[model samples]
Target: MIRFVVKRLWNGALTLAALVTLTFFVMRLAPGGPFSKNRKLSPEVIANIEATYHLDEPLWMQFGRFVWGLLRLDLGPSTRFRDYSVGDIIASGLPYSLTIGFWAVIVATTVGIALGVAGALRRNGFTDYAAGTIGVIGIAIPIFVIGPVMQAVFALKLSWVPVGGWNDGWRSLILPVIVLSLPNIAYISRLTRTSMIETMRENYVRTARAKGIGEWRTIWRHTLKGTLLPVIAYLGPATAAIITGSILIETIFALPGIGRHFVDAALNRDYPLVMGITLLYGGLLILFNIATDLVRAWLDPRLRHDG
Candidate 1:
């Protein structure tokens, strides 16, 4: 177990290193160097500004400084928000993102799994058809489309909920979270339906039936237990996707989250904030994946014993 965990941690470290390097070069490659304005600038002024930020130094030297900062957990200053460091921006913004992402995951996973189980159990019936239709619509509609229509209907037309803001007492989050979760709900539901259906046909399920076990008990004990593995595996990637997808969702809703920060950083070419946000998100994904893998291995005894 120690060896396995160590291996996962090593891989995660390598992935982080590659991501940082790639993000640095890619951002640098983009035109305008973070301070290029449409307005004309005097030569001495430009030199002074460049010198102030050490952009005067060679790229290799800058890269070295970046690596040193990484080792010290110091995300550099933001280009757009001159007074704030990248770390400070993240510190303030992460909570908002977490709040939305947490609610989104809960709603998505719970509904998806339940509807999927019901659809599988009632295969070829109305329940299955309804579930499948809902899933299709969720998958087809982008969050951008869903967000506006929902805001128009619920907030504009009905005035039932605020269009956006953290002050709406959880009600404000209803639309955004639903829109954010729609795709994930659809995908997980489909996965769960298929997995449960397949598990229901296994020899153990047949054995349980032959033993005269109650229907609910047989399903809860056998089918669900087996189907859990795939669901667990999907969750890791789903979480990463959900958080990244929020980059658009938060921007549309005008929520103060890391996703929105990422958008702002991109437009302004705020390299530190952009790269910091990228690394933070990447680290979360790696950590989630590793956790999911460990849980899967724990749940499936064969995994740990296998070469």
Candidate 2:
């Protein structure tokens, strides 16, 4: 177990390093400087500003300095928001992103699993068809489309929630969370329903039924544990998608989160902020994948022995 964990950590570090290197070079290659929008600065003033941020340095030197700063956990200064460091800006927005992502995951997993189990248990019935139809619709529509339609119905027409903006507490969070969770819920439900249906046909399930075990008990004890493996595996990538995809969702809802900061950083050519947020997101993806592997191992003894 210790060896497995160490291996995963080592791989994660290498992945993050490659991500940083690639993002640093890509941001530099893109046209436009962070100061490009400044109104008519004298050449000397522009040079001074560039010097202050080491932007005037050779590309290799700038990369080295940035890497050195990262070694000490420094994210450098934000080009657009000159008053704050990249780390500080990210810190400020982290809570909102995390809150929305967490709730969205919870809702998706809970509701999706229930729908799937119901559909699997009542195959070919109304519940089965309803769940299947809902899953198809959720998967077909993109979040950008869903967000506006939801906002129109719930916020514009019904006036149950604010149209957009993060200042209204739980009511404000509702629309975005639902929008984010929709696709994930659809995916989880489809996966679960298929897995459960297959598991119910296995010999152990038949054996349990032959022994006169209750239907619910047989499913809960003998079926669901194995049925969930695929869902658990999908969750790692699902989590990364939910977090990163929040960029568009945040924009639509006018939420103050790192997703919004990331978009602004990219558009303004703010190298430090852009690279810093990219690294943060890459690290999160690695961490979530590692967690998924660990949880799978814990849930299945075969995985433990194989590892």
Best by TM-score: 1
The digit string of per-residue lDDT tens for model 2 on 1-307 reads: 9899889999999999998899999889988899998799999999999999999999999999999999999989998999999989998888888889988999999989999999999998998899899899899988889899988999999999998888788988899999889888899999999999999999999999998979888999999878998899998878876765478789889887888776788899999999888988898899999999999999888898665
> Which stretches of model 1 miss by more than 4 angstroms?
none
RMSD per candidate (Å) reads: 1.9, 2.1
Worst 10 residues of 1 by lDDT: 240-249
Candidate 1 lDDT score relative to the true structure: 0.86
Ten residues in sequence with the least summed lDDT for candidate 2: 237-246
- Where does candidate 1 clash, by residue pair? none
Report the backbone clash tally of model 1. 0
**Tens digits of per-residue lDDT for model 1, 113-198:** 99899999999889889989989989998888888998999999999988887888789788888888888889889999999999
